[model samples]
Target: MKWTDINNIAIALMDLYPDINPQYVRFTDLYQWVIKLNEFDDEPKRSSEKILEAIQLAWIKDAD
Candidate 1:
């Protein structure tokens, strides 16, 4: 997917899951994950999973 597409998806995800800190997720990472989601043909579910994973990792680091 294009950068703009990935960005839009990320923004939507942020709105849907406010508990996730958008700052901790880099645009490049989101783009890469978007590509993976497309490749796997599970874009929505995988994208949501990736966002949750990123949020979990960020929270873990914050606690450290």
Candidate 2:
């Protein structure tokens, strides 16, 4: 999964952290978690705040 795979990343995050609320997640932690995803594959430096926000939003939606 690359940075563009927002939904996939969100799903992975939901699976990895079912107890945590995506709404309360900080960007710093989100960044680390995204980069560390087993299926994640992309330039870590390619991520931006906009991309992170999209991922977080998607995660929140999936968590609901």
Candidate 3:
């Protein structure tokens, strides 16, 4: 995945979890993770995992 893709994911994440700390998982981290995944030939899987994790985390927080 590219930086633009990760950035778009970050924006959606932020919208879903507005009260969460972006500092803990910023767009930069997502971009870097995508780059790292590219090295392992697991970019798509890793990206989907991260996005799902973000969504789950947001939902958990909302329930609390």
Candidate with maximal TM-score: 2
Predicted structure 3: clash tally:
0
Clashes of 1: 0
Residue-wise lDDT of candidate 3 within 1-64, one digit each (tens)? 3423444444555555567665466545544544454223434434554564564455345435
Q: Model 1 over residues 1-64: C-alpha lDDT tens digits?
A: 4332434445445544467565566646644545554323334434455555554454445434
lDDT per residue for candidate 2 within 4-63, as digits (tens), equals: 999999999999999999999999999999999999999999999999999999999999
Worst 10 contiguous positions by lDDT, candidate 1:
37-46
Give per-candidate clash totals: 0, 0, 0
- Report the lDDT of model 3 for residue 34: 41
Instruction: Give model 3's TM-score versus the native structure.
Output: 0.34
lDDT winner, 2 or 3 = 2
